[model samples]
Target: MPQVKGSKQYHMVVVPHRPVRRALIIVLLLVAAGAAVAASYYWGYHQGMTQQADAVAERDRLREEVSVLTRESEELRQQVANLRLGSEVDQQASDEMRKEVIKLEEQIAALEEDITFYRGLMAPGDNNTGLTIGALNVIGTDIPREYEYKLVVQQLATDHQVLSGYLNFNVVGRRGEQTETIPLHELSSQVDNEDIRLRFRYFQNIEGRLTLPEGFEPERIELMAQSTGSDRKTVEKKFGWLVQEL
Candidate 1:
């Protein structure tokens, strides 16, 4: 250590070597580099935390939306189930209505059959036999000429029974003379029974041609139908002749 005589100051201040100066500068630079690394580490950590928070919030929002969608799906499922149940109920009701209609139709048919049976019972004389005569028409315009007649008879009862009857035709001439009785049996051989029973009706469709004698003009014709039974009854019909020249 050199000092100046009679002075408090040192004689010469020693300068630092280049290596030491470099070492100091390296230390300062290392400290500054350490501070910069710390600051960068803190900034990066903060940024990472912020990003994590945003991701968590997004996840929660997505979960809430999923829950809402699940609830809506459940509601739609319930509605679909209700609709299916309603359809089944409607189908069952339709089936019941069809059954009721069929039952009503059967009842109506049964009633109609019963009414027909009762009507047959209330009728007179064997209850099932009936005779109907259509309109009688003369063949020609001349009097006492050949004539054609159509008759329709029906059996009201279901039983298959035959009926036998007789027809008598009386003719009156224009000159106040009466002809003999004309028997239907002489013209037809279809008589097999005397009394007509239940389900037995006689249908006499007689298409006959009769010749009149010369100089005898028929003024009126009388038809008598007689039925053989315990209580015999006869039906008579009279027809007037239209005069025409031959």
Candidate 2:
């Protein structure tokens, strides 16, 4: 052989061709099935966790609402109790006020009695006949259209024998267009047989009631006394119409 610029070497090889694509496809299908099972398991676990979190949050929210409602109920109860206490206190105060009023009225009545006693001791009567009308109190009773009067008579000189006397009570008033005189015996139902007589040496108290007629109005009163001794003594007094009733 002539010298060639390049020498060529040849080697013989044998390869067997079979259907390996179907086997590869079967392997790929098994791998894909395993991956799908793992992904499904992960998704189910995540969904369960999310549902549990939502349930816990709802439970907490309901508990908070229950706590707030409980607090409000307690507050309402406290307010009601305070109102009841305040009402009790107010009632007690009102009762105390009523008691004070009653006590004050009693005190005022006692003061008035004391004033009358002192006045009788201080200023003597104007009658120079050794006899005096000390006090005249007109009081009202519980009976309707009825009045009571008190006359206190005092003797300055005990020198006389018990100054025996009787009182003549006369009421001077106006009727229609004319002047009228009313007698004490006519206005009272208890004036009979020496009932208006006084026989005390120092003093005498005369109390009696006077009931008016249907429409008779009284204005002034004249109280006259007649005493018998060696010389008959007479005294007259005038009093304004003053009476009280309950």
Candidate 3:
């Protein structure tokens, strides 16, 4: 090459014919695709994390609600149990009170009967004045074939004189299909004499424990009260053998 002054010079140079522009365009496109893929991944990750946090918070709230409900249910069960126990206690107390009331009523009835009996014995009625059999009671004991008997004889005379009499107690019943009469003295250890002596002005109660013979079913009891010597009066009474157990 020669340098010429004040004029344009033409020279020849060598250059390689390669596809540099196409390669540069391809590289730029690849870089843009990578940036797009990174952005999509980051967004997806953020969205997933938010959703997971929301799910965890919801699960905690549901657990708390379930715990509260469980506590309430337990309290309700305890209240029901206490109510049932109280009801049972009240029922037991009611039953005991009922039993006590029944016992008191029975005692009152017995006292009233005794008051009436004593009043009748002390005062004499006009037409009903005589030596008579007042009452008879037969009670059963816990031991089989054993019984206690009570007999009351009253003299209802206006004179109020001392009464001397002998009383006879007899039990009439069947011993294996045969009619039999048993004396009270033979069946009881307390009565030594066959005729029990009655020496009372107003009334006298004769009580004794007796044992019935084996297989002897008593149907009725017969009592005979007879006064001696001056005022000879005889009174007889009969009673069914209704045994009250003690």
Please name the candidate that would achieve the greatest TM-score relative to the true structure: 3
**Distance (Å) between predicted and true CA of 50, model 3?**
99
Superposition-based RMSD of candidate 3 using all C-alpha atoms, in angstroms: 44.5
Off by over 4 Å in 1: 1-133, 141-161, 176-202, 242-246
lDDT of 2 by residue, 28-89 (tens): 99999999999999999999888677656644654465556555545545554565576578
Cα lDDT tens digits for candidate 3, 74-114: 55455545655765788765565556555655555554455
For residue 190, model 1's alpha carbon misses the true position, in angstroms, by 12
lDDT of model 3 at position 131? 86
Query: What is the TM-score of each predicted model, taking all chains together?
Result: 0.32, 0.47, 0.58
What are the RMSD figures for all models against the true structure?
A: 49.0, 46.6, 44.5
Q: Lowest lDDT 10-mer window, candidate 1?
A: 191-200
Q: What local lDDT score does residue 80 receive in model 3, on the 0 to 100 scale?
A: 47
lDDT of 1 at 209: 47
Q: Which candidate number has the best lDDT?
A: 3
152-246 per-residue lDDT for model 1 (tens digits): 33333333234456655555565336555433333223432322222233234554445555556666666666656554455667777653333
Worst 10 residues of 3 by lDDT: 58-67
How accurate locally, in lDDT, is each candidate? 0.52, 0.67, 0.78
